[model samples]
Target: MRVMHVLKTVSKAAPTSLHRSASKTSTRGRKSPVQRATAGAITITHADRVVYPGESITKGDVAAYYQRVMTSLLPNVVKRPLSVIRCPEGARNTCFFQKHPMGGLHHVGTIELKEEKGSLATYMYAKNASSILELVQFGAMEFHVWSTRIDRLETTDRVVFDLDPSPRVTWERIVAAARLLKVQLDELELTSFVRTSGGKGLHVVLPVNPACSWDLVKDFSHAIATRMATGQPQEFVDTASKTKRAGKIYVDYLRNTRGATSIANYSLRTRKNAPVATPLRWEELSKIEGGDAFTIRSLPRRLSRLRKDPWENIDSVKQTLSAAMKKLEVGA
Candidate 1:
C-alpha cells in the first residue's frame, strides 16, 4: 500500500512540472518583436544614464528605450496606441534621455531637432541637461521618436500659439492672456488645450481636423493672434523687437512650420529634466505660481486629480484647416 501511494504522488508531480515548463515557453513566444530586440541588445547600468552617440542608433536600441521609459513615465498616457519615427540623418539632436530618475527627472517621448542646421553634438548640448537628468531619475519613460515622414499622419494641420510675456511681466498678465484665449476659443466653438511652456509663457493648442491644409491653419492662427492683440494691445505684445516687447505679450504663429513639432503635452523635457508641457485649466493659472509652481517634477501628482481630459473629445472636434481658416477670415 505504501509503494502504491508513492507512485501516485510521483505521477501528480510530473504533470505539474510539465505545466510549468509549457507556461514559460508560451511567455517567451508571446513577447513582441520590440520586446525581444530590447531583451537581446540594450543594457541599463543606471536608471538615469543615457548615451547619445555620433553614430547611428539601431532600431532595436530605440525600441528598447521606448519600452523601458514609457513603461514608467507614460503609464497613464499609453492606454492609446503609439508610433515611432526614426531620426533622420543631418538632423540636429538637441536633446538627451536620462537613464536614472532624480530631481524632476522623468522619461521623455519626443526629442527636439533644433534649428534645422547644427551638428549632432551641438544640438545635443543645446538643451537643458540638468532638467533632462531630473526627469530620467524621477519621471516615467513613455517616450517616442518622430521622423520627417511624420507628416504622413492624417492630421497635417497643427495650430500653435507662441506665447511670451514682456520682461518684468507680471503673473497676472499671463493669466489674463490664458483667459482671453479660452473665451475666444469657446466663442468659436472650437476645442483648445493649454499648457505652461516651462518658461515665461503659456501655449494654447487646438487640434485641427486631418483634412485641413497647412496654409489654412497658419492663417487661422494669425487671425486669432491679431484679434487678441487688437483686444488687449497693452497686455498683448505683437512686435518683433525684443526692446519693444517690453510690457507686451507676443502671439507667436511661427511654430506652424513643416518640420516643427511642439513638445508633447505632459512630456518630460530633457532640459533640466523638467516635466514636459503640462495641461492646465484656466482657473489653475490664477492660483499657481507661474514659473516656480510648474516643473517636470510635480506634474505626475498634479495629473492625478484631473477629472476631465482637455482633449477627450478630440475626434469630434477635428475639422478641415480650410474650413477653420474661412471661419477665421470672417472673424468667426
Candidate 2:
C-alpha cells in the first residue's frame, strides 16, 4: 500500500526564515503582489499562503515551480488521468488525495471512464498549462498520472517499476538494484529510463508502444520483477508485503496495472521541502544521494544548468514489449 504523508500542523510561533523575509518586504498600505500571481492564464489565489511551512513555500511558490517546469512536466501529465495530493490549508495542515473531479472547479476538465464493474466514473485531467495551474489553485501539490492517456484508456504506454526500498537498505544497494534492472531490461531489448520517486525510491520506466493490454503489461513487469527477486533473494523482493521487504528493495510492478498512477516527473512530493520526482540520466545515478535529492528550490537551477534533458527522447521511443515479454516468458 502507498503511504500518504500529511503536512503536520506547524505552530504559529515558529515561522520559517522565508516567511520572515516576506514580512520584512511588505509595504505598509498595499496588498502584496504575491497574494495573487499569474501562471499562464490562471491567477493563483492565496499566493502567500505557505504550503510548505517548514520551507516557507507558499501556494504561489508552488505555482511558480509549475510554471518553470511546465515544459518538462506537461508531457508526462497532459491528457492523462490524474490523482492529486491536495493540501489546501498548507503542507503542514490537512491534505487528501483527489482522484475524481470536485464541484466548482470547471477550469479543470474531467473525462468519464468506465470502471471494471461496468459503472461510469469521471476522472480529472489537465488540458494545458493553465489547467494545471488551476489545479494548483485548487490545492494540488503532487500530480500522479496514469500510464495510459485519455485517448487510449485501454492501452498503456509505459511500464513502471517503483523500486521501493526498506529502511534497512543502503543508497548504494538501491543504486545497484536500479543498474541491475537496467542490465536485465537491456538483455530483453527494452530501453528504460530512471527517475526519483521524490520520496524513498526510484522509478524505472520503460516507454513502450501503446499496443499491449494492461494485463499483458502488468504481467510482463511482474515477470521481470519476479525474475530479479528470485535470482537475488538477499537483495530484492517482488511482493509488496512489508514482512518480506526488510533489508531488500521491493520491485513494485503494481504501477503498471490499469487505474494505477505514477508520480509525474517534475511533480512536487507532499513531503517537507517539496521534493521533486526528477528524471536522471543513467550516468547521473551515482551522483544523486537520495530520492529527495532534488527539491523545488534546487530543481529549476539544476534544469537551467543542464545542457540537455535526461529523458530527451522519452516521447519518441515507443518500443513495444512483445519481443521482451516473449523473451522473459521463455526464460531466455
Candidate 3:
C-alpha cells in the first residue's frame, strides 16, 4: 500500500512536529531537475474524472499542472503546515476544509499543530512534487500555508498586508490603494512583493527575520496598517466592518496570527475562471484590472515566457521589522 499512516508524536513539552519524507524515493541533500518533473511517484485514481465541468478540466489535468509547477511552488510551502480545500466531486460539488490526519493519502507530508483548544492535530504539508500531485488525486482544489515554518512555529518569516476592498470600491481604486501601500513600504527600505489575493483585492508581503513572536509581529503589522489608514482615511480602513469600509479598502493584518494561513503562491483558487494566486512586480500591479486577470489557463504561458521568477530573491533576502518600525515611528 502506498498510503502511509503519518504519525505525529506530541507531548506537553514538545511543540507539534512531523517526521517528513518528501517522496517515496527519499534521499539526503538537494533534488535534481529530473526528480522534480517526475509525476510517476503519485498515482491519480480518477485520471479521467472532470473536476471542472464548465471548463472540462480533468483530475489528470490538475495533477499534471501541479507537477509542472511543483518545482516553482515548493519553497513557499515546504515545511509549512497547510489548509487544503477539497472539492471531491468537482467545483460544482460540496467542498470542505481538510486540516488533520490527511485521512489516507500517498506521500503527503504531515505536521502536528498546537491547537487553541489545548490539544494537538496532525496537519498535512507538501514536501515534493509527488506530495503535491498526491493531494490533487485526493481532490485538493486550493492550498493555503502558514507563513511560519514548522521548524520555527513561534517565529514568523513574513508579514502580509491583505488589502481587502469593499464591494462598492472600484477595481481602479483597489489598485491605487495597493500602490499606496507599496510606496509606503518602499519608503521604509523594506522590499515589498505584491500579489493578487485571488479574490477582489491584493496582498503585499515583505520577507522578515523570524526572531519575534506572533503577538509582536501582529502588533507591528497593526502599527503599519493603522498609520497608513490614518494618513489615507479616504483610501483605507483598519477594520472589517462593512459600514466602516465604505469606499475604502480594509488592511487585514490579522493573518499574522500563530496559525493563520494564506493561499500559497501559484496555487489555484475557488473562482469561475480558476485563477491562480500570482506574484507580481510593482509595475504590473498598476495594469491589472481584476484579480482574475491571470487564470490557470494563462499562467503556464506567463511562466514559460518569463526570464526569471519575480520573487526569486525572496527567501534569500534578510529583513527585519526594526528598521521599518522605526521608519514608521510605530512601536510594537
Q: What is the lDDT of residue 241 in candidate 3?
A: 85
Candidate with top TM-score is: 2
**Candidate 3 clashes between residue pairs 3 or more apart in a chain or in different chains:** none
* Span of 10 residues, lowest total lDDT, candidate 1: 4-13
TM-score to true structure, per model: 0.57, 0.90, 0.84
lDDT of 1 by residue, 116-202 (tens): 464221111102222222222222232321211222432343477868887788877787787788788777777776777766678
Q: Assess the local accuracy of residue 246 in candidate 2 as a C-alpha lDDT between 0 and 100.
A: 87
For candidate 2, lDDT tens digit of each residue in 268-293? 99887789999999999999999999
Highest-lDDT candidate: 2
Model 2: weakest 10-residue lDDT segment is 9-18
Off by over 4 Å in 3: 1-38, 329-332
lDDT values, one for every candidate:
0.46, 0.85, 0.76
Listing every candidate in turn, what is its Cα RMSD in Å to the true structure after a full C-alpha superposition? 17.6, 6.2, 10.0
Error of 2 at 10 (Å): 31
Regions more than 4 Å wrong, model 1? 1-42, 46-157, 270-275, 321-324
Report the lDDT tens digits of candidate 3 across residue range 1-332.
Answer: 11212223221011111122233333765552211222456556656677777787766667777766766788888889887778778777777666664556757778767788888777778776667767777788788898888889989998888989888888898888888777777788878898887788888898888876688789878988898788889888898888898888899998988889888899887667778888888788777878777777888888888888889989887888776767666432
Q: Give the true-structure RMSD of model 2.
A: 6.2
